[model samples]
Target chain A: MEKAQEIIFAGFGGQGILSMGQTLAYSAMIENKEVSWMPSYGPEMRGGTANCIVIVSKSKISSPIVSKFDSAIVLNQPSLDKFEHAVKPGGLIIYEESSIITPPKRTDIECIGIPAMKEAQKLDKKQVANMIILGAFLKKRPIVKIENILSALKKVLPERHHHLIPLNEQALEVGRKFVQ
Target chain B: MGDNESKNEPRLMKGNEALAEAAIRAGIHAYFGYPITPQSEILEYFTLEMPKRGGVVLQAESELAAINMVYGAAGAGARVMTSSSSPGISLMQEGISYIAAAELPCLIVNINRGGPGLGTIQPSQSDYWQAVKGGGHGDYHLIVLAPSSVQEMADFVFEAFRLAEKYQNPAFILADGALGQMMEKVVLPEEGSLPYTVHNWATSGMGKRKQRNIITSLHMEPEKMEEVNLHLQKKYKEIQKEVRFESILTEDADILLVAYGLGARICQKVVELGREKDIKIGLLRPITLYPFPKTEIAKLASRVQHTIVVEMNAGQMVEDVALAINGKCPVSSVGRMGGMISSPEEVLHYVETMILKHFVSA
Candidate 1:
């Protein structure tokens, strides 16, 4: 609560990058924590890398647009290129190993690779790959409880897609396997 | 965490959706808006919900049609609103002038995007001149409200309508794409909880009225136009008391920062970063962009060593701050053009390397 978690999520447009940030913000809001979720918008999003920033804090958040990040969840190589230096020294970077060819070059920060895309391919719903990555991130830093995330998943997932909730929860648990 | 009180519950919602929900709760009778990026959610939300709530939601063919619809609905004693982004709002300028001249009450929301023409759908404050100074035409002003947060985006819906009807003038909510697209937790008001008044001057069909109410902005005679202009000027002066601003850490500040809307949110971080470096910096945020808190700014100008105005555009509001300070303090501005926003570190760099070295003493 003393220090806010400023996080950036970057991936291709189909990688569910924006929704991952939104889900965390929704969970944070559920816990009465101050939350702000901002997405990288405009014409560049057309097949380009889509990204978002999510900040969760106890105190009121001042600026939602920030340069540095306490953590990053990057799903592709281009994202690694853009945000590898963005994470604060000694902070965390959870990257998808399957999509990225070159790993992060930074030695000061903690970089963990979760083969999230590969893991999601095993699941019935491949789109829950982000949730798997989220689960791995939570294993490293449990900012929000899994139960709260499940509740947030209900809100983030449309009603017709509600059937995927349990599978997504399983994917989250699967994500913890890569890190631990 | 299990507070369980509905009133205390905060909903995480996008700024654009929050604006739409607030309008429904604020008891608007109609919504006339075309679809545009970053602002399309407003029209979509209204279309799905407004009709169910016994209100009309019409996606007009164009922004011009939307604004004219707003004028017609407001004249018919209906609380109405229309929304658009920069280019779309530019199309409605003439109708806005007509509504202003007719002294009709309505809400016009512009989620400003970067533009001179068909610019990117990115956030910008370039429309400040169009919003506060006069986007329309001749001798008329709209009560302009610029909000920084998602909560304020919702809250200002009620506030803008209140001010519009109170003064019998059109009101504008000048927001940027960042504020429109971002999601934040908001404590929402109840549905139709806010009250609004229907005025006798509105032509609500004269069934039992002694006099027929006619709504028109046209005046052929020069003297008649002058008389109406005099009345409008007096109303503008009276509305000056409605000016709103927020001061953060200014009481003991050495360097003052002036910004509005989302720029103010960024300056808040500038204040925090400056304080970390033992810089006595404060931020003065203007909420009412049109009323232009000149008196409050002038008062703060006397004590601070120097003032810096920050905005998204190339120093639009800075000129107003300079005029407000009136040579009492040295005023300079930091601005980002197009859709690029000012980062806090870049501002701190400017402050430490440029501003502190010249203006404020260590």
Candidate 2:
């Protein structure tokens, strides 16, 4: 039916927030789905809050910028507080349970807290935390397959980081476990 | 196509990075640029890339130095380029004017940012006047191409070079911070895809040639300067036929939205949203900001009841839109300044409330 999905991924600079969105966008493109990844950038990127909006559509994406979102993947408390009201009613909000102290206020939307960082700690690689959230996102939305994301990783990840693909896949599996 | 199996595969590339790759494929002999936010990626990509391809990539001391370097390379018949943001573009005005006067064919990319002076490093169409109207002194115009997508961002680099050389003038890819910072899937041109073009008037070396070619903008005599202005005007008149625009859903449109670059991208969504409500809205996206599609808008003006110039600045392109319409219909401006993008909902609301209800009904 040519449905379009708009998602916002938010966290601090070093949290792989942008790359999480990028991975989704790259995976969508692999499926020949039109996609855009718009990052919030500037000097604040030195070490401030970071976020990216990823849109995937069956048809051509009209705009790269949007205020309201179909879903949100927030890694920190500030992002939750900021984007909580921005989600469409009945939309999904997946947050890092350990990072967000205050719960999401919305009663209409489905807000799930997955301890992605806690899960990544068990995997012994903190960098794969965002992939865990990504895995959880896929479990709920199933917008793009997990295998495509792994293939996308091969394209986006540097040569040295290719060794971490298996670790990333394992993290995605851990994230999927929390959703059901 | 060289050795890569997935040569036609779409790669997710940022707009600035895509432009760098496209410039490489367009066979630019050299790239001279200074780093600026949102556009430093083009310079960074070129530095890491051009070395392997036997091309010169230099980070000049400033935007001033970089533009002058473009002039030197171009005068030597090298396909050369440079890029900067709004403030840096302003700094290169004098040099750009000189290049324009000398009729040097080169590519200059301005990833426009907010501002009058060192404005915040955010997206803005404030430079529309600077680019469309003469930014530098004198009677010269750059062939300006405004791209609306990451794909167009790559595609227009090749077009800009072609048009610049064809017209013997400098060309600009006037994109903004949002377009530059965003990433989208694109199928880039193959490496070294462009055919080599020869410049007969180049000062490379005489080497037993009949005449030695000299390149300069300075004319000591007033008659000579007047003659130069006359020829430039004639060339510009010829350049007007190169106007490029896209008309979407204009068949029965009551309201027509005129925009370019990111503004057009945002308004494109507004058209879809407005059409959902049966608002009969359409969009005219001008790909070439100069050589503007004035006649196209004028033709559409007769059909549409009203036209709005959607942009980032307060009302930069609104005048140009008005000029195109020429009192055939009413024209207005809807915009957001300081790098703030006007969301689809905001613009659609403006169309519904401000135009459809207030103007169309009244």
For candidate 1, lDDT tens digit of each residue in B184-291? 999877766777776888899988999999999899999999999999999999999999999999999999999998899999999999999889999999999989
Across B108-182, the per-residue lDDT of candidate 2 in tens digits comes to 899999898888888888899999887999988999999999999999998998899899999999999989999
DockQ scores for all predicted structures: 0.64, 0.68
Pairs of colliding residues, candidate 1: none
For model 1 chain A, give the 10-residue run with minimal summed lDDT: A40-49
Error of 1 at B282 (Å): 0.1
Task: Categorize the docking of model 2.
Answer: medium
lDDT of each: 0.91, 0.91
